[model samples]
Target: MRVVRGREFVADRAWGAEDIASMNGVSTRLHWTDQPYKWHVNDGEEVFVVLDGKVEMFFRENGEEASVTLGVGDIFYASVGTEHVAHPVGEARILVVEKEGSV
Candidate 1:
């Protein structure tokens, strides 16, 4: 068990993550970012939750690019084959849930 104060969380580097848990084949993690993440598609679905600060989420849908601003408590769901990336407004903390070893 662990306790993370999201408001006080500082990223080790851009898009850095702290492993939280892995059960069966799924994993949960906490991520901190001060920059934009690389665009990629996950092997499985992804659940992204903003824990602190703000974020600009971008995704590719039907060959078109779109984006949205996410605040604290906002959740983003990326289904399999969904190409997406995240841009933190500043320093932000996020929770990610997905299949183990997926990228």
Candidate 2:
């Protein structure tokens, strides 16, 4: 059992994460970042939750690019082969659940 203070969490670099659990080839993690992540497609489904600050989530669909601004408590589910990237509005803490060893 554990309690994580999201707002107070810090990482030496962007996207650094604290592993919470791993089960059945899936992992849950808490990530701290202030930088944008590279665009890529996930090999499996991913659950992205904004825990603090804001994020501009960009995704590609049907050969078009679109984006959405996500605030606290917002969730973004990325199905397999979904191409996307995340850019934080500033410093943000995010909780992510996805296949173990996935980038």
Candidate 3:
């Protein structure tokens, strides 16, 4: 069992994470970041949940760039082959669930 206080969590580097759980090849992680993540596609589905702070989520759609601002408690679902990146408004804590070993 584990308990994490998102507001109190910190990372060694941008996008650094704490492995929360793994079940049936899927993994759950808590991440802290003040920088943007690289645009990339996940091998499978991804669930992004904002735990604290805010984020501007950018993605490519129909070859055009698009984005949405996510606040605490907002959720973003990225299916396979969805090219997207996350830019934190400042420092943010996020909970991510996806296939293990996925980039």
Cα lDDT tens digits for candidate 1, 33-91? 89999999999999999999899999999999999999999999999999999999978
Which 10 residues in a row give candidate 3 its minimum summed lDDT?
Answer: 1-10
Q: Report the candidate with higher lDDT, 1 versus 3.
A: 3
Poorly placed runs, candidate 1 (over 4 Å): none
Each model's number of backbone clashes? 0, 0, 0
- lDDT per residue as tens, model 3, 29-89: 9999999999999999999999999999999877999999999999999988889999999
Candidate 3 regions off by >4 Å? none
Better of 1 and 3 by TM-score: 3
Q: For each candidate in the order shown, give its overall lDDT on alpha carbons.
A: 0.91, 0.95, 0.96
TM-scores for all candidates: the values are 0.94, 0.97, 0.97
State model 2's lDDT: 0.95
